[model samples]
Target chain A: MCTTCGCGQGEGRIEGDEHPHVHEDGGGTVHSHAHAHDHAQGPGQRRMVQIERNLLEKNDAFAKINREQFVQKGIFVLNLVSSPGSGKTTLLTATIDRLKPRIPIAVIEGDQQTTHDADRIRATGVPAIQINTGKGCHLDAHMVGHAAERLNLPQDSVLMIENVGNLVCPSAFDLGEAHKVVILSVTEGEDKPLKYPDMFAAADVLLLNKVDLLPYLEFDVDKCLDFARRVNPRLKVIRTSATTGEGLEAWVEWIEVGAHSAKVIRGEALSSPPCRA
Target chain B: MSLMEGMLRIVEENARDQGFGHVRTVILEIGKLAGVEVEALRFAFEAVADGSIAEGAALQIEEPPGLGWCVECEKESPVESRYDPCPLCGKVPLNITGGTQMRVMALDVE
Candidate 1:
């Protein structure tokens, strides 16, 4: 239900039309009532109005605001996107544990419904907020902006936004992060990158998680990396396994470098105004 | 159809601004690389346009071919996806010049 206006979605409202009714029971009691609507839509009433606006413009506008805030605060924000059961949450938990002692950290977890992931992150002793995007297949920039408002992120901290577990819709929406880390597990098909080329093309880095399971599975790690590169030549890839703690240090090092770079860049931007900031 | 929802919002807002009573049709210019399925969009318009000024509205989509700029060839050409190497030079990366756009073009309103 809409808070400002009672015209909630799914419940149709008649704002400009009305249908009135009256009835007299033979007992001399008369009743009158009216419901809104007039369904006589004629062909001649329709007129053309030009719009010509991009569908992603609204979301991108909000993303720009979030990006500016992150740059100002010097927070290294990484948007984690992947298909369901790709071990994003597990990887996040492991990474947080490895880096929480050295650098301040916060998390914004996105899921269709449940605080399950957020609960796991909190157990690791870092502040985490869960955004339940009910009926929303993906998280937009506006939702992330509202979530960031309440996150109370510290300066020079790392903000990891665990995006909803979907590869298609999340590929188009930018949540204003320094990098979008797309995680693909060995369990999934190596042909996934070729099938979902849009997701691979949009990603800055592709994480091949669950590498520990490579020996047991028929998944060809090299072939998958080649497919990812074929889609996006500039994609930086890292192999990791959250369960066995393999490649976890490299992932942490990667984030630490990003966080440190964000700090220095933000400092330089402060001393001299950013060129296009 | 989140893209449809975004387009519908703009359509309805434009109707309100123009003092139109209702919308009859919405014309969209969807590029090939917009990552939207034309069949799915036509089906989803029935659901996303419900309860708004565009309820029961007709959706007319115009699809444009995907266009790309080849850095090696220094020419613009048509390509399906970013994964496709440049047709002219067979380059690894061809910068996208067009397509991948979902926009609301015009609305037929009352």
Candidate 2:
């Protein structure tokens, strides 16, 4: 009999008093000191099996790969993050229109459910891909990976990823962009950076959108800038109004400079930044 | 967020792959700066786990505080969120060392 399977003890092993035993009446009687070994092994195995950390490690690794790929391609990618109705789409549309006929641009639009922003970008005659995330509040590396496959972006083009209109979830996932451009409209509130600091903290550039509405609304621009700076002192802040095309030229110039810098860093070209936009 | 939900599904699949009949408890490790709400995740787990192996599982969440290394300050500082400035020296551009995570660490099964 196999002792390991609790069958009759092996022929060489007698049903001996050497082993610890538990009675059927729920009372246990230890016959040997070796029983302590079994007690220690159980907790030891548990400690070895338990792992702590985000299971999204795989996604993060993929994001790093995507970032390297983007850098190698010399494409300047910007991840636009903001809340719903924050003028992100409008700003992109205005920027695209201002920079068109000079800068080769493309867009990857992420939304919970809609092709609306993609349609708006397409109207500018630039190639665009609409990623409807369904119920997903954020765009992960996997989704961006799929979008990259579909876009087939030019080696020198500017790729702007308009993340899902969410301040929280989108900030957590890296889409392999060179910069995180966070858009906060004055209509949202001055304390937005403090309320959702992660988004502001992750931002490489902060755009104060819808500044044209500042006069009519009670939104304080200086307070918002001060708060944003406190959260991230190194953050670059740009104020713009998509409606009046205010500050758009500087925005376009910024992208052109970034693209040129990326190209030069990659040894692609010594070409000057586009001057038309 | 659905990312967290998808992560939980993967955990369930992994449990099933191990021949688990049901998952009674799940130990989840979520970083402080992962931008996930523990209570909201628990509610989402309850809703998403319905009819699955995790249907009745109790969600145990562990949140580790965020840690950042400020290049400007040249030291490590503990932070509550990603936005918190360096404690020793108020500065921007702190490199995040840890606490931006979301994962299922362990499970209890019968």
Candidate 3:
């Protein structure tokens, strides 16, 4: 209990203000108000409002709208996340080079401040939009929804969202993608999945990139895979290297499978009206 | 920080709906496996809630322990980390059952 005004319980503290409930009482003496601020409802007629809601409720709502839009458009969206210098862009460019010729491909590049990634994607003969978050760490669904509108995405297309190169924040913000592909490079520690378990847990696929450098470094591939599985049993992993073109074929095939399914679902939806609850 | 913004929005919306003059307390329920830094949220909450209706409102956080259901044991047990095995029987991967939630449970208003 706070010795002072007893405003907060044991844990809560007023940010900058020290004297919480001191009153002069129109006299020279100053005293603190003795109000019951306990776990239960206080006696001072203060109401205890019950509001059991999630912190990401607003973001989740926006993501749901984006998901519906994507499903309706037959757009197979993938949110790619990784640490800085983990070859997210390199892998994306390589994957785009292969998939663009077959399907209508679009890119949404997210970074703190830069049009560099988007420019790189456009050079591949595909439309790409840059979402510079300024000081924001991650790209939210609201931003992606607006970007998708600007892109005017095509049906039976593949939209690859290269998220800001930070594993922590991106895992929390869902962009309504069909799957979240986490890129972990051999250049980094093998224990990355253990250190950042939430990203590994949330990710549907794990792209272990830069596998060409595996022989030179002390990076334990087996240990890395084990740790990733420990965190997420269902994480589909693909050992990839953009430089050597090792796993690009499998990656492209995976995208194709998802895109084909989305197209089929969209066709079915169009043929039959949506069931009303 | 955005989470804090979400928290304030929720409080403000409640205040508008419930006809509350001021919010005196905000109680949050954060789980152990929610991947949120409690200290960071607490430090950021003061600044985020400043000059708003929830300004000076005491922020209280309740952390629920992580729980996982073990296939070998066929029972739920307490866990500290995601990699931890089942306490009863050593299992490689225990299915997560609880403690991944982050929410606002209640508020004290006047």
Candidate 4:
């Protein structure tokens, strides 16, 4: 029950204007979305049950299922996260253009409305599926699970999942991706890593995009790196410019290493027994 | 629909498992740094809880303070956000220890 135009008020249409209703778990998200408080309250005394369970447990459960699917299918999934207009879509297109032929690649794009990003990925001649979260601010594992199923990414292929542009909520939701790559443009505040520490801590890598504009802007690269390192000591930082393709090579190398490592791990798992997380 | 819906679904399933048809109150434990807006969650509950076990449930939110481990001070500090400098050392990026929780801690059910 997610509406595209109006925020989460109703379900949204899919890519084309023709066929809509591609929401995840619409079949039974809640078997009783139409549940009205019609049941009689017959001496129902309130009692407390200490559930002590995270609200994202359901999403994490779906994420585990997604992780298993990725492992079994040997697909390398990368969740791209960033603030809006951080040049996430541009980076995805550039990455796709560089790596699509070398290794089979497919993209799952998330946005509030329209098929713009998905259409851009498709322009590079790769399968791109757009998931409109409608009023949802982030892409949860449940949605990604269904999106992956629909994309049907090939074995040993790279699956880039561009999360909805928001550094806040996306950090908490795991989409079963091998890694969460967070992009921060130089134009944005250099202290974002500190400001949004959860996102920095959750991210596996930080892409400092729009580095070409660094010369013009007062963005302090060193400070940003220091802040990122402070938040996550192990976070790998990469500077990139999708327009000039300056740091795309190093980014490509990083992707290749990640994809290869994911494949190898999947291979090892296949050779041995699967380890349940 | 992603988070709150999932939560209500679990609550309903729990109600079925425990034979409680009605939820009187939902005491949600949300950390200050949990990145969730309680107001939005309440809105989601209003939208998705209709006819479910939690339809008429009262939402009681418990916001626990954020806990963080400071490296320089080598101590745990109460942090409201990651941006908050270490309470002890005044250093940024304290490892979050608490207050990032987004869970159903306790539910007053019938």
Best prediction by TM-score = 3
TM-score of chain B of each: 0.89, 0.87, 0.96, 0.92
Over the stretch A1-277, how does candidate 4's per-residue lDDT look in tens digits?
3331121322544453354444443321212233434444465666777787777776687688889889887788999999999999999899888897688998888887778889888999999888887766778776677667778788888999999899988898888999999999998999998788889889989999999998798888998898888778789888899999988989988888878887887888889965655
DockQ by candidate, in order: 0.48, 0.19, 0.33, 0.48
Q: Write the per-residue lDDT of candidate 4 for residues B1-110, one digit (tens) a residue.
A: 56677677668767755667678888888889877778988988877778766888888999999888888888998876666778777876678888888888778877
For the record, the alpha-carbon RMSD of candidate 3 to the native fold, in angstroms, is: 11.7
Ranking by TM-score: 3, 4, 1, 2
Candidate 2 lDDT at A87 equals 92
Best by lDDT: 3
The complex in candidate 1 yields a DockQ of 0.48
Compute the lDDT of residue B103 as modeled in candidate 3.
Answer: 94
User: Clash number for every model?
Assistant: 2, 0, 0, 6
Candidate 3 clashes: the total is 0
Share of native C-alpha contacts between chains A and B (below 8 angstroms) recovered by candidate 1? 0.64
Chain B, candidate 4: TM?
Answer: 0.92
Q: What is the lDDT of residue A98 in candidate 3?
A: 94
Residue B22 in model 2: shift from native, Å?
4.7
Clashes of 1: 2
Q: What DockQ class does candidate 1 belong to?
A: acceptable
Which runs in model 2 stand beyond 4 Å of their true positions? A1-48, A268-277, B9-22, B51-53, B67-99
Chain A (candidate 4) TM-score to true chain A = 0.87
